[model samples]
Target: MSAPRMITVWGRANSVNVMKVLWLLDELAIPFERIEAGGEFGRTRDPDYAAMNPNATVPTLVMPHGYTLWESHAILRYLCRTQPGGNAFYPEAPEARADVERWMDWTLASLNDPMRIIFWALVRTPEAERDMAAVAKARDAAARLWSIVDAQLEGRPYLAGECSIADMAMGGFLHRWFSLPVERPELPNLAAWYARLKTRLPYATRVAVPLS
Candidate 1:
């Protein structure tokens, strides 16, 4: 029998969190229906969506066995395991895989703060309503963070040098960092890496869409 299919993802398309899952699904070549939720749509807090996901967050995954999954990164990891060739996205080794996981974790743990403010100011919030102060702070902080990534890409093609999940996970946020309205100093290495990631199908179809 074929693998069961009852997968549905709930989230708005413009969300970075939602984009991560979409890009992963695209890379895995899994077909899924996405219903609009969260952000401006505001269905995330409804009892129906809440019942499936208590956190009321976008990008909830309804599995074939009727299991519900929440949190964006968790969904990425789950899909990486469930799909065929999943190990390609998230490997099953000790050294290289772990290193990839580290950068993916860093995107959520560290990059989120900086990316959020920058994203909101440039994409979500209108020009007059934007908080220039917060945007500036986030831009500076994110640039500092990018400097670390710049150093990491000294001779690598991708993070961990193989286009693993770390690149996609972090790529979603870095899209905004490069596109947002801010003065960024010339960091050729980071810029070049971002350019290379743009060539991926997932990055082009999902992550590289107009922010917001």
Candidate 2:
């Protein structure tokens, strides 16, 4: 492994995507400096920031050797691949690693579809202008997705086994799912898995904060 290098993360603290990376960094005990951008901070639109990350998305990572990466999940993989103790979290065995990747991919490809809509409606949309009907439909869809996860957790402690990056990716969003005002179905297994995730100090301190 090359010498350890300082990393810089650009994003607002409250962003779920940003929080996911932060939680991973903390879990790995990697030292990093964070700059608040995006959302109300508004630095993401700056020309220099745009040049670094064309998407202008929160959680852009600037690594040693001038390597820049965007997309929260990609950042997670980069850190895991390069850092010591990565195999435990990311795994070197192809099958073991794929087990982790599937959940991380599902977090974006499947879960985010409904979860994002509901999160925005309930958390961002003002009560007076909010469309409760739309929120309800989105919430129901998200619940169905969570049920699938709940079933997966029935026989395992973590999604990909032993609390890998898969847990962090899904746990980041799970915070929103559990915190929302909408009623949740009785997903005992999912609840237990979440409880296990919460026991991590890094997750509790960084990712479990109040939602915006």
Candidate 3:
């Protein structure tokens, strides 16, 4: 009998998208190898890398059978659908799954832009070169978006009413938002949800990390 082929993930550790995949993998106890690519590691633009991921993005997944997948949220869904115990995270019920998926979509569609702006301005840009005005504007936008999340999480411990990929999708960004040196509106539910996520070991080790 042949040994099972291990899954390979390509991306730098600090990337929020990559962190989401890693956190899920750890939660599922799935073994995989990670290769450094993108950011300072710099293979994203290589022809071979582009062949694997034309978007030149990080968190590309090479499956055990040699198939490749990209897009972090899509990858999260694929992993949960295929791996053992994945159904617990993704759910088999249509309505339940949709609840999980909508937040994933919202994270990419509504929350990502302002979060990216805030993250880049505050973390990546040097203080002398920092755009405080842009940071403040993005911060306000992000706070409003998080307010939506806060409302959604009002009676639930996690998005979709249980721990699911929706939380994983937004977890890293939540950590970054709280960690950033910007003024933020008081969001109790969001803060409580974040505290709940922190107790999960995978979230603490993988999603919550010092921003680069």
Best by TM-score: 3
**TM-score on alpha carbons, each prediction:** 0.93, 0.95, 0.96
Residue 157 CA error for candidate 2 (Å)?
Answer: 0.8
The clash tally of candidate 2 reads: 0
Q: What is the TM-score (0 to 1) of candidate 2?
A: 0.95
In the range 142-197, model 3's lDDT, one tens digit per residue, is 99999999999999999889899999999999999999988888989999999999
Query: lDDT by residue for model 1 over 1-212, one digit each (tens)?
Result: 12237578889888888888888888888888888998779988887788888887778888877888898878888888888877888878889878988998899889899888888778778789988999888888988999999999999998887777888788887788788778997888999988998888888888888866
Clashing pairs in 3: none
Tell me how many clashing residue pairs each candidate has.
0, 0, 0
Q: Give the TM-score of candidate 3.
A: 0.96
Per-model RMSD to reference: 2.7, 2.8, 2.3
Point out where model 2 deviates above 4 Å.
Answer: 1-5
Q: Cα lDDT for residue 166, model 3?
A: 95
- At residue 36, give the lDDT of candidate 2: 94
Better of 1 and 2 by TM-score: 2
**Pairwise TM-score winner, candidates 2 and 3:** 3
For residue 202, model 2's alpha carbon misses the true position, in angstroms, by 0.8
Q: Record all residue pairs in model 2 with backbone atoms less than 3 Å apart, i.e. clashing.
A: none
